[model samples]
Target: MAKFALLIGVSEYQPGLNALPGAVQDIKAMQRVLQHSEMGDFADADMTVLENPPRHVMERAIENLFSNRQKDDLVLFYFSGHGIKDDSGKLYLSTSETSKYQSGELIQTTATAASLIHGMMERSRSRRQVIILDCCFSGAFAEGMKAKDDNTVDIKNQLGGEGRAVLTSSTATQYSFEQEGEDLSVYTRYIVEGIEKGAADTDNDGMISVDELHEYARKKVQEAAPAMKPEIYAVREGFKIKIAKAPVGDPQLEYRKEVEQCVRNGKVSVIGRRILKRRQSELGLSVEVAAQIENEVLEPYRQYQANLREYEEALAEALQHEGTLSQHTREELKRFQQLLQLRDEDIDLIEVPVAIEKDTIKQSEFLYQKSTETLIYKLRHQLVDITSTEIELAEQKEYKDEGLFERFTERAIEAIRLAQEETLRFGHNFIGTEQILLGLIREETGVAAQVLQLKGIKLADTRIEVEKIIGLGSGFVPPELPFTPNAKRVIELSLEEAKTLKHNYVSTGDLLLGCIRLEEGVAVRVLENLGVNLQNLREQVVHTINLSKNKNIQSQ
Candidate 1:
């Protein structure tokens, strides 16, 4: 008892772009196979042949697919045309008449490739869903494109139940091609042709699953163009394609269940709040508590401003007594002035007026200083003793040669950058500890050397150590893998662990404790040799963070 198919072909639009030629061919072939390709009860699909559909109509098509699928059924969604995103990565499906850049804010936003897959996978039924995106910029469209309807790109995590998969024409940045003589897209041509010939079942399992068809289409297209790479990403449980040709039957109840699960209603603001709620457990504070702490810091910051004004006044008075401030004081003042001069980047720090009154009342004193320019930089109200630029510059500067620890970090910065790049590519703003761990493992020198030496541990040797621990026949792949956590936490935990044993900065001891916290790496044995209890070390880090306000050396 195979289920029904939902095939939607989008080629024509009002927004200057014409409907694609191959779209009709693709739609026809898919329609033919879906009705009678295999073990279905021969049900005809309710087809939607849209040409330049309105925004709401396209969104409805996505909503319809997931909302109408069943456990044993296969739901197929196909798209063809031009797609693009703005600077913020919000995707837009052009109407034959729309502008790529200035799409109206009120326009109905379409589902991105990532959102399409993730949403459909949320279904509770055993039904498998397959989506083929045929358009320029269609590859990573679902994953990276923001949820325009929601006003944010941050999608929440919701694992799908069974049978779901996605097959797309190209990666997000690559442009898909259309056949020259025909109206259909080159991508659609191969897919439709493959279905007609029945080469989609690669494993010869008698029936074609979404995964099978996707892999076949991707391979088949390589001959058309050597440079074009098509990709298929399979998610959720297994599924099969049961295509049959008959008049439509009653829509399956299981698809209805899957569709019910895929409804992701609301905006990005709501999604962010949900993420914070889940993360609060690890912080040991409610969202309100974190906000409270932030508010508490403000009053003291204002007080610092008052102190800074007083210091500046006193310094001016002292300068008058001597006829000018000392060279060091002058240099410091000049530093603040320079900061004020180049601050267009952070406009919030434009408070302090450089023309403060002089302590000495000489006639020449007021007229001596000449023209000036204004600049902006973000400054802390509590840091009244220095300009905003100085505060930030101080924060950004690494302490060097302050014992061996400073020297160790000076050399490790580049290695850290490489790891940070990798994390950034995955779309995170900050490099977390897992990246730091990976960085250390990659370099194994300088700061990494210090990290390893604290507990007399070595990463290369530690892999052997891990083999030793699990060698006793507890064959579970160690969960909580290392070098995967956030970099800041890794540094914090590593530093704190080292400090317990009285090490000056991060050392091998820190590295071992890090691996131990991961609870599965061979690096854990080093902690055992150091006579450090894993429970005690973990508790110590908790205590340090709870008691201290800021552990991040590079504080925001």
Candidate 2:
């Protein structure tokens, strides 16, 4: 029996539809796997790919895919694009020319209807047919079909054939999602990964059946995005149709599956580690080999978590400056999302709640504004006088041309060194505000440590809170860790505080002031969680600085 396939990818759409840049890439990926000699074994001339085809071109292609095929021939049709359903619930696969009215009504004539594809499928002589759809509302193509014994739609009844299979990226009512930072849609990515890695050959029979491929892709898609539920439909012997060949008795594949089971929330569980150790011995693989495989398996999860943390930190810093995000901040955030390869949906999950929390705090503060205005006014006047005296003293001292490093006191420098150590301890590659706070507390002789201790924020408790907030990193710390933007801002603010306090060198007290000044940083969050009163803490640090200044003046 010969194999023939047609793949359609629609990326450019009319004004009414959003562009899907990944759709074309999806077609390329599928083509690669389907033409692999050891896998799909389909001849190059037997496979066809159409990218961003117009409605008529797409319709003709679909007709040709199922036309003139023998009963024993294997026919496959794949589409990745927008899937729209009309009010009557008929699904249409969109094309480059697909458009909708301003009222949000679909222009049916502008797209290829599923009914046409079904008609083509019914007229095909080939019994071995596979239809794979990676698009929104894709499952709706099986509408009006009978349910099989397994409760899945009967493709034979809908698309019409004794031996047929259909796989959709999402349920009838759900939308198929494109993963951010990925070259293919979430469903298609797993599908390609399964075929390329031979992980779909679950039974180790060296063959990847259509049903097995769908099952493997479904589990992986759900793991990455639980809201998505990929569906598969088959009838008669369709479920047993072998789509590709897998490497049998592959030790790496065996180990990879075990590692998948061990991974949870992006990290290997303690029990999972023990299980992996035992599996390694049984598989007769060396420790280094197993570790390499496990790392490969875990990389995706770790990358996702890292993206989330980076976005969260950037959002937190932005929220500190204003209750409502300015246009500039919004643009900055968008850049962050793109740079971090995060999806809009994923970012919404982190941003919405944080914004609501900030709004709630603003509302509560407004309620007390009237009562605190007079006290705030008095404090401001007092601070002005203190600032004037400090500035006069600061000017009296001779200035030196030196870098920021030369301006730091020995204790301040030690605290920074401790910050890098803390970063390594947390397995993180960057020093963030939380690490800086830990460093300050660890430098026991620094004034920042003294103030923190007096406020009941112990080093041990702070460490716990820091871990709870940011968690451990991916365990690949670089030789030289960089400082996060917030961390760098803290150092800049500390230098300003030192200059304002008439200290030629940046002291630990100045660093503490800088941390307090950064209202939105992880450091401030930890301090608040530890029950430290920030305003009072700031006043105490200033008061202590004044007392030290007076003692020095008297001794001189």
Candidate 3:
């Protein structure tokens, strides 16, 4: 029986429609498989391809594809383009001339109606007919068919006949997606892959049936784009129609299937690696060959993750400049999405959470501001009153004088407050040792600041070094930020330093010693980066304390 095929791809469209450059590449890919000797085995002379055809040209080619065919002949028609629906939900296959008005109304005359294609299929003499559509709303071709409760069209009841099969890229209500940076559309890419790689041949049969081809493409399309649901419909005997040949018992194909089973979240588990190694030995495949196959299977997943990271980085950078995204920033981010070849759905998954966090931060800041204003007003008007519990606690603390916090002098307390301010200044949500170091340098009246200045370590230089070590934070900053474990350890160590000096109260000098003692803290890293000698700095602080003590004794 003669095999005839006509493939139509419309990459160019009128002003209103977005151009699909992948559509034309899709037709080329399909033609390669159909005319391949070991695949569809269709004669080159009988194969026809039309690229960016106008409405009339596309209509005529489709009509001629189904006309004057023998009953036993195999006839296939494929289209890759925009499939739009009117206000009444009538599906139309868009041609190069297809466009919409300013009101977003579909210009019916510019597109080819699906009804026309269905009519041509009904009048065809060939029983072995195949119709494949890769476009939005392609499943609408099964219109008037009995639909499932979920709105899925029953193609077998409506358009299926003996030896006839229909395949679509998406459901009746879904939009077929085209990935950016890809040469072919997502659905059509898998279709060609199934045929070229002979992966469509299930059950180890030497030939690939139309049913097998549809199932393979459907599974793969969902893997790359979960929202897309490819579909197939066929009547009795149509499911068994052979569309291509396969290399039976191919070891590479078997290995690929094994690799697919072992992969999760784009990685092979430790146990999965062992399983793959055993399979590789059994198949007599070299290690290099096995690794190459595994990489190929993991490529798409890796690309997806890489795209996510890129988008998140860009968003974080934008957030560093402002709490909320500005209109210009939003527009720039949209353009970045296209440049990254990411879909709107994919980016939404990343952006929505960050946006919510920003909103939360704004509310928290508002509350914090109001509370601060109230505190200032009370202090200014002398309206502040100490509660009985607070007074009792203070009396107990002064009597004991054992609590390390109570031992902190007013200057030391100011240093700690300065540390928290430093944390917020850097847009960080948590106070770390780096901020404590900066606080000691900023409290110029304290012994710690005096010693640092003597050693030529200025606050500005320390701030720069700290920034170099820990870049600006991109997340939300709450009203009360907690200190990191290392920062807390520094505070505890400061109390110990005060006791070592036989002092009744903790001083800013003690805080500096605490930071120096915690060698693993980021504060130490910043100090080292600033070319400070920790041992010398410690000695100078001790000597300065001694000089102050001697001066006090002389005055007495």
Best by TM-score: 3
Better of 1 and 2 by TM-score: 2
Model 3 C-alpha lDDT per residue in residues 1-556, reported as the tens digit of each score: 8999999998888896667788899999999999999888989999999999999998999888899999988899898888776776556788989988899778999998777888898999988888888875532212111111112333444456677898888776554766556798878988998888787787777898989999989877766665567888888878887888888777888888788789887899899999999999999999999999898777767766776778878887788777667999888887666545466656655553343333334443443344434533432233112112322454677733235544565456667678877887898888899998998888765567767765678989998988898998876776556678898789778878878877656767788899999999999999899898999778766655554433331100
> Per-residue alpha-carbon lDDT of model 2 for 1-556, expressed as tens digits?
8999999998888895667778899999999999999888889999999999999999998898889999999999999988776776667788899988998778889988788899998899999999998875532212112010011232334554569988988776554766445688878898988899898888889999999999989877765555467888788888988898998778888888888889887789999999999999999999899989887777656766776788888897788877568998898787566445455556655663344344334343442343334533433343332223333343476323123444555556667678878888888888888988898899875567766765678888998999999999899966546677888788789888878878655767788899999998999999999888898778767655554444331100
- The global Cα lDDT (0 to 1) of model 1 is 0.42
**What is the per-residue lDDT of model 1 for residues 1-556, given as tens digits with 9 covering 90 to 100?**
3453455555554443444555556666566555553433336544545555655565566566566456665665666665554446555444444443254332334323444545545742536656566654523212112111112222122222345555667555454655435545556766754455454544444455566666656654543332245665554464354332222221222222122223232112455445544544544565566444333223222333443454445455555566545787655544443222112111112111111122112322332232111101111222122223433444578422122223122224434544544344434333444444444555543323333333344555543443344333333322222233333344445565555645344433254355456543333444565454667444433333222212222110
Q: Note the Cα lDDT for every prediction shown.
A: 0.42, 0.74, 0.74
lDDT of candidate 2?
A: 0.74
TM-score: model 1 vs. ground truth: 0.37
- Give candidate 2's TM-score: 0.55
Q: Can you give the TM-score per candidate against the true fold?
A: 0.37, 0.55, 0.58
Q: Give each prediction's root-mean-square deviation over alpha carbons.
A: 26.0, 18.5, 18.6
